[model samples]
Target chain A: QQQVKQSPQSLIVQKGGISIINCAYENTAFDYFPWYQQFPGKGPALLIAIRPDVSEKKEGRFTISFNKSAKQFSLHIMDSQPGDSATYFCAARPTDSWGKLQFGAGTQVVVTP
Target chain B: DAMVIQNPRYQVTQFGKPVTLSCSQTLNHNVMYWYQQKSSQAPKLLFHYYDKDFNNEADTPDNFQSRRPNTSFCFLDIRSPGLGDAAMYLCATSSPLGTSGYTFGSGTRLTVV
Candidate 1:
């Protein structure tokens, strides 16, 4: 199955609040997980990523928390700002798939002032 | 800085007409990808190129075809543009399939009339 499910198809948060988006996968062969951020009319850019070996990874205001046993991972945005309003996607792929990323449905995050 | 570049940020096509989208990368990555994203939905991967080798997704439509002339240039061709084919086409690049997240071009928006 090449599906990665993401929850809260849309999210709304206040400035300086915390934004959380969750994703789940069915394939245990997926060892790499990454999150992408896309602005309107633009291509997606890698925001943050994590491997099963690490439970959590934080870069700047973004963080990825992974649970290998549960086949789930989440993106957490700290000190959310209006500039962060955009679409967020979670993707996973097996080590041998050669960069074929199975992507989630995506989360439309809106940070209101 | 290393990045991906796409030409013609927007495209307008008529029914039965064909259109081509281009993407180039300065990163010198060995892999390139094409994706389609409709409004309010997550991006869907259509296919990718690992070096000079191409990998096609099983569900990709027959109307869609791709060509990679060299390591840095890739093209997405829609033989017959249809209303359903109107969406944001994104191009991405990475260093081999097993590598980390990719760098993406701004994308081309297609509108079929």
Candidate 2:
């Protein structure tokens, strides 16, 4: 019930194209959802996040589209660049837990120029 | 420039040897977490500390232990590391409410030979 399932283990996109990653969770108590980007030899960093109350959230080239009733969410990268190539993980923070983050398996996104 | 910091980016230990990974935070957050990430896998939560209180995952191995002597520093101790223990250990910090996001350190890569 605590798992967050992500799809498309890997993705390949051309420069200036749109890249999308999706995730779904079984826990209904999850209110905070965040996406993290990880480069080689580095820890995952927060990319963007959304709460269940909002249907979408955008930050620069990244956006999060959420569906509360479906228990799913997705990240959209507009004008994808090579520098955006990294492992992206979707995580959900349980409402009851202080800081427990449940992460997906991760998606490796490769943008080809 | 406040962030989480981890020392010794890379560490190598022999089988059955003891190893320790340290993490510190300048964010002065009340929550600290330890996660283990194998290549191409999701980051698995091993434990976390909410202030001085410790919370361990039910599936976390007995060999994995943690210590938080004070608010600024936390440590992950592997009493007897095996080959399967080789992975990247990540340390993260979050505020009391955690509405923002968890800040992760660069992480320590442990190689068990």
Candidate 3:
């Protein structure tokens, strides 16, 4: 079973626009939600993350809005730039399982100038 | 900077050939994980080691095996490569002490010819 589902297999946004990606999960055990950005031929790097305790967390232009009761979370990139164009993935880890992370399918984002 | 390192950024192996991929960490984290990511797909966990204790995913193929002799190093041994095995292998490390998430290596792209 796919524990996490992500929408919009691909996205295109103008430079300086807000690029948003969403993810939903069915596992209530998941307490940690993290977003990762991956360029071609590279590994996924942690972009932003949020715990169930917070409704929103922002760092720089990247923000993660998490809703525990709804079992949903989203990543928002403010003023998305060409540099932000890459594949993004959402992952969740259960508090009981420290090392196991369940990942979403992924979204390919492109920023056009 | 302290980080996860995967060797042989690109590897090509013939069908039925045995191959091994290596990973090392400078972060000295307690947990190490191996993930297989196919093109445009989410990364799937194959196995992990929490300080020498190997944990394999229930669905992972038997042809895949992993070993961690020490904290600094881990190895993934594919007893026999198949065409379908071609993918990017990522190694990641994390400290159980905090919820900061994992540090991932650049990844090794494996091509089974």
Choose the strongest candidate by DockQ: 2
Clashing residue pairs in candidate 3 are: none
Candidate 2 chain A: 10-residue stretch with minimal lDDT? A93-102
After superposing all C-alphas onto the true structure, candidate 2 shows an RMSD in angstroms of 1.0
- Rank order by lDDT, top first? 2, 3, 1
Error of model 1, residue A48, in angstroms: 0.6
lDDT of 3 at B60: 99
Best by lDDT: 2
- Return the DockQ of model 2: 0.90
1 or 3, greater by TM-score: 3
Quality of candidate 1's docking, in CAPRI categories? high
lDDT of 2 by residue, B11-85 (tens): 999999999999999899999999999999888889999999999999999999999999999999999999999
lDDT of 3 by residue, B1-113 (tens): 99899999999999999999999999989999999999999999999888878898999999999999999999999999999999999999988753778899999999999
Give the worst 10-residue stretch by lDDT in candidate 1 chain A: A93-102
Higher-lDDT candidate of 2 and 3:
2
Model 2 steric clash pairs: none
DockQ for the candidates, in order = 0.84, 0.90, 0.80
